[model samples]
Target: MNVLFLGKIQYALYRLVLAETPEAYLLQTHTLPSDLNFMPTLGNGHLGYTVFGDAIFMNGVYNGAGGNSKRARIPNWLNISAVVCDRFGCATDDDELSTTNDTLYEMDLRDGYFRYRKDYKKLGITLEQRSYPHKYFNRALVYEVVASRHATTARSNAPQFLKLSQHPGIASDAFEFVVLNNGSNAKGDYRVIRGRTQVLEFERFQPQPHEIYILFSQSLEEPLQIEWPTWQMEITHRIIICIDREQSVALKDLQDALELNFQDLHQKHIKRWHDFWDNDFSIRIAGNSLELWQIANAGIFYLASSLPSLTTNQKNEPFDGLSPTGLGRGNLEADYQGHSFWDTEIWMLPVVTQFGYDYAKEVLEYRSRKLEAAKYNAYAKGYKGARYPWESAYTGTEVTNPCCPEVAQQEIHISADISFALQKFFAQSADFDWTCDKAWPIAAEVAEFLVSRAACEELKQVCHFLNVMGPDEDHANVDDNVYTNAMAKIALEFAVWAGGMCGNASTELFEKWQQVSNRLLILRDVDLDYHPQHEGYKLNTEVKQADTILLGYPLRFDKSSTHLNDLKYYANATRESGPAMTWSMFAANYLRTSEDWRADEYFERGYKSYVRPEFKVWSETPIGYEGSANFLTGIGGFLQALIFGYGGLDFYRSGNQTTMENSGVLMPPNVEEVEINYIRYGDSKCRWIYKSHSSFMDCGYRKSGKKFEMLQGNKRTLLATNFNVTHRKGDPPIYINLMN
Candidate 1:
């Protein structure tokens, strides 16, 4: 199988082929039939379910809880499983399975549904299944199962039983199953509800006092007995699973879900997916490379699905935000523990911010909700202000594995990461009021912590941050990490700048922040041309990932030749197996330095290594480890490589002009053209078209109602008013030329 055309290859290359084996299965296979690691999963941001052949082996939701024991804290609940059986008894795992035939198995990316069909020729029975998670309904997953006669002469006494298994855990005893029939109601003729009990555990906080409930109901279009001497040509069944920590809520949601027509729900799900693709930013490269387009689309889909909407209940929720491994219920021990890391603010949130501001606001609000917990954590450690935990889960407590104390205790950059995200959101959105009201407080507190964390060497006129861990987890407990100090400097400066804007500037705090920002000790070599990853990093040239080079991209600091040398140095030293975001950082930095060819090369390399072969989603590592498949941080980095790197887009406010700054389209020499359509930058929608000789850019603002200028390199061009141009709600598409 070709690697470039993985997911949508068959569809792209040959229109006649109905189905092909999913790339996921072709690239990675499980030796054991029962291994859930290689299963395909579907979710609607809140609930996730894994599909194995025709059965759903594991179904779970993002709930803050342990599996069975208090010490084994599982932030998700693996609740239900479903399998098919005939009158002869349940079918074994060997029952033929294939997703290679279009008529047999199909995963519709546009419709957000998976369908599979299997034929038992000897048994004269055929089974088809279609499954999808409802986009609008947060609590429900829908599965449609069909059983039909294989041939006209196919006569059999085999009655199919769609076994719905409710397995909560080993420690819970509260389990109930019930079957109900709607009298004369065509849509809700027969239904079965299964409920199970579970427990929730927190490492440093009190466990949830209530019993968690997992409820699922199976509704059928036609009823069937345990045995049937005669069967119809086809019979259809619909199953819906509704999960909640509270039994009452689960029951209510289940009933509400049961009341909806199956066809309507499925249609709504399709529409939701379409709206996501239409409203959010989209990229259409001019090429037959289906992999590139599919990867980008899949990234957006995975990132959106992994995040919890604002409607989700936050109380007793396991950080109920975003997790490193998403809401997947992997092996009990191999689970990611549903913890949020610095990855959320630094890598993931930027992508979310670009797609929609409301979603971005919700992410920030989640952090705000945990502010008090962060403060308590800092105070407990005898630090001022708030110090976010390196691994934060429910209650925002430090939940890092006990064995990895360096990550939990010494990665002080987590605080700076939060501050940086807040500042980025503020600067990009230009919502000064919201920043002042909501984000500034957090930034101010983080600034306080940074000031306290830094030790000022008065004689040397430098503030040193010692014994800290940067993004590179390989190097632990290191001193003066360049990434840490650079981000810290930005955090402190933002706090002071935002404080004055909000009329809450502290004179002493400002002085301290300014002093630290100016004197922050960045570990540089003897020549002061290339910054080291950390102090003593020069001794052994084994850099873990993009540490010092980060100063050039997201930080947008060091733009000098020294920064270029550091980028070159780390480019050679960084490990290939480092985090997925590392390569994209290199791509972005190269783009900033006008090295278009290298930027494009690194972008392609990053996309190939970071993305999964089957789903085109990003995992932690290229080799498919136990991490979030949708890994938003890597997605954000990849997007930065495209939008910020090649498109040359950045946000800045200068001299009464608050607008997106562009360095024109930096097309690589190898590529003839590149185009990005409908990129959401703040309140505006931007489109860029670049060719070998010239580039065209258009910016349209829909909400701000403020006219913004585009700075192409050194030239500033005001977008023409909609009255004189194509208008989208009175916001005209402002066109500018970079090469003219």
Candidate 2:
């Protein structure tokens, strides 16, 4: 029950206890009651739900209508079950209740809701249930039930019933159920819907030409009796399923979400979950590791309920975004068809561009609406610009997995990782006319497909990149793969520095991007001095992750002792079942070499083995079963090991000054202190904090005349408008050891 806000904490309410059968509650559950693979999910991001104990399931809307067949583009189902009856018929089911004795099972992550309870005691009855998924009626889904009896063990001619069932998926066949009596009732009580009232309606039909419409309504009114043996009843079910390929507009949006008003749509779904946890960007760490502050506040609410905003398909297009099992519903024989990868522009758009810069500009506007299907997949492979697709979906072509054709034809650094996430979203939203009308023409067609897919060897003038696949999918078609030649030399020097900041500079494409960023090959081994996760990768030291310590942290491109000799030679050559963002990129390259106790022992061994145990949720290997479970690239590499590793925070752009550096905070010898508090940077919100030897920061700019500077460890400070600085360890050093 913790759940606090300004005074921190933010989430809690677990409480479990179910073992009364189903194979002793499926051997004390850890998922597998017919697997929704480690269940417990609820999403507002284009509808999602899982909860199994007494059924909930549901997952539609992304590519909605039986999704245009590739075996109906996955994500189906919309179950929702409930039942409890009596009249000497004694019935009770919510997966046959039994938290051993007086049943209970919760999961409330503060108001996202889900509860269940039971207590019979020789029929003196008691039941309680709650559910949610109507964050502001986006096609509604609410449930509430309550029953109590006990007037000295009530039995005065018992009569009770509360049944609700809607199945809608597995490619439906047909269905409909209704009970609506309109006697001018709008909660004028009339014994709540008149005479034990019941008004349920269902509709289903599937075949890619999909449709679903459930609409159930209740609050007691139809033949639901209990002749006062000390009664107390309360019901509230406002189902509404909807889906659509137009079955009469999915039965008029399930009768306008069962005629609204469930306490004003549950107070506008609790003020849209309190404006989604009070306007995003939040983190609070004080120390004694409560499992690293509940895995960094449940990895920012499972990446904001698994990537919300942006939904359209069945022809209205717009998808190519959230995947890695986001819109949930998987398993019809290993499905992940809900595509988009290169792990969403390099590990979930840098932790969703720090709390949504308009959801990281709708994931670069879904890669500028799939840049003309990535320029016709580089003009049917003749190549020369826009080749983005190591598994896109809803039409950005290359839907991979045709039995992994070398990651769909040699993972050509996913078009330079979508031109380095559109040059780090125009260098963190400086937004020069939307990076010259949408990301510098897709970063000049991804530097013209990495200069026509590299290779130009005119006798060692160098520019190889050969047979690629670097973000370690375990050495496939390798050669010169130092994190794909340092992200194709930072996407050809950020397409000649974003084509000279949008004036569209191109002196012969800036000398073919300075001869492919100075002969791009990058392999280096000089007798294990380091850097060689490619080009015969030093005869296999193995590594299926952090390809060369990601060139000294998110391609800072090598520094000091060659970034600590390739971060201690690939952090012991990776693979401890690699993936979970490989020890969060070896805890952000061991906190960029300050090595804070080896970055707090690989960030507590990558958060106690890739999260998911008592459900802190992360999963993408490390014994949490095959991929996806709120794994937005291992929660954006554990929020880049706590805001760029122990809050050292970075953020570039030097010439027209934007800086922000920090390089002070480290605290990892069993963390005695740490605080990030907030991090939005760029349209600022910064914050920092640390302790041992002092530190402080605020950066500020929740919208004002934006200007910044603050360096730290080597003194800078500048801030132009909103500020709050403080340094300490003899002040005059606010960040300039630039990885010396």
Candidate 3:
């Protein structure tokens, strides 16, 4: 709500009043360079192709000078963007005209005007014609005139056979034109009327690359006409236009004017800002908890302020942040800017789902809406299911280039991310209808695609096609990435559930999914009591086997492996492999399994160790860390740890029955030094601890058969039970159970 109290980071990022308007503010963040910028040859050439998070990448234009892997040799200018809209705000169909193409459409308002040099009229001719940037902003640029023909009244008879002069030429050539003649060479000749010269100087100028100059002639017959039909937001029209003969115009004053008029864009912007403010306010977590709030607000700010609309109104666009390559650079470099990765579904989705469902809906809606593009892609690739591009844009074309040159290329993991988002949307929101209306069909289609993408490993078992990169891009193009396999199985399972519920499910589709699900393969060895990382992931006596927390922590596919044995092994593997975007998930997985005391050590090692010691920013690359809270989705697990780990509460539903169990933690759970008030749902009584570790659960349930027991972890605690105590053996831990 109140921008000032949002937090320091938000205040810093959200308070930069835009030059276009004061009410509008810009959000800012930065991306790191790849590999510490070790090579001098690195340049901006491929920056546009890197995909950063969910931001769409527009290809970076060639800057005349070539580039390399490290440095981005673009212009030196302050990267500026004005806030478009906020959390509650969106550019609707009414904001821009509907068309198959998404380019900005302009409709000129009546007050349209053109601009040109004032002194050109003094030389018995007007040199060139210029146009204002927009009706609101009086910035001007010159336009070249081509061929012109006019027929005047005989009374005028000024130029029946006009001669053209002083035509401006390009650096090396003169202007070319098509001369018009009468029907019969000598019949009636139409002459050029007021043949004027105009030229556009487009020489490469990096320093003043996009300098906008505005000028108004003091002796003008009519006001320069200009208008944009697409923009619905109000804007300040009054602007200072210079008419002096000076070749260059200073932007210092103009920048000030732009910032002042930023208020004109304020109405649309503030509406969006307030929308996010209205969401569930994050509570203070201990210490200067404002930082946590800052994390959330800053993320929202980045989404709101960074997307500069090339069109009048665009929705759900990604912010380029503070990268030097500008927005046109393809998926962000370092973060793989041009590529659409799984981070959106795993890390970012929950935050949006919890705070901005409308935004979250747009995210899902993007996938659903793009289904056709995905389908066409699959068709082009000779597959039955929609295959998403590893990195994509407006066209839904695949952009993933495999590292290995010899193998056939494929961008295979996107289907799983799509399914995961759909599942998250369903789980978090009361939108079952969405599943029936949109998600299921897409899910079924994706399942169909997965089916076509799989190979029969055995009877009732299918293995995903090999040589596909999994979540970790570092070890790319590997077969049966454990995470990828887990995702596929879950996707197929969800697809089956969705298809069975489809009232008019396509028979062919259903059979295809059934066939695929039947043959889906999982990397598990019953004889060795092990879960292989991949199909052929073997471990020598010297090479230790690693644990994959994804299967148990996130998917819950294997309930029997409640306490995973190989977590330490995987932790070591991740540490040795260096940092990765997926590493946070793995760390959170270890935190989920580790008992109370052990969690603090692993949390620090995984989360804090990698985070920047100064600003606490988490960088996608090891070169620099920018704080991103998308990985904070694991905070939900912290809550779970309190209830299930220490509070000893577990709730499960089957058929018509619901079960709840709990134990008092007495001592709160600590997540990165932020303490959680432990609470449990059982016996209708709330158990809590004040200061001491001793805990008691005052059983509130009066049912005769309900029972209570104390759960002791590394420490022993009292369970003050008022219900009949039931003792059971072979159970791992004590639990207070409530029965109807």
Best by lDDT: 1
Q: Please tell me which model should have the higher TM-score, number 1 or number 2.
A: 1
Which lDDT values do the candidates have, in the order given?
0.62, 0.59, 0.37
lDDT of 3: 0.37
lDDT per residue, candidate 2, 163-226, as tens digits? 5544434432122223333323475311111011111111121223223333334323233333
| Candidate 1 local lDDT, 496-584, one digit each (tens) | 88888889747987988888899998877857578888887763477667778889878887888888888778888887777778888
Candidate achieving the largest TM-score: 1
lDDT score of residue 245 within candidate 3: 13
Give the lDDT of residue 669 in candidate 1: 29
- How does candidate 3 fare on TM-score? 0.52
Question: Which ten residues in a row are the worst by lDDT in model 3?
Answer: 38-47
Order of quality (TM-score): 1, 3, 2
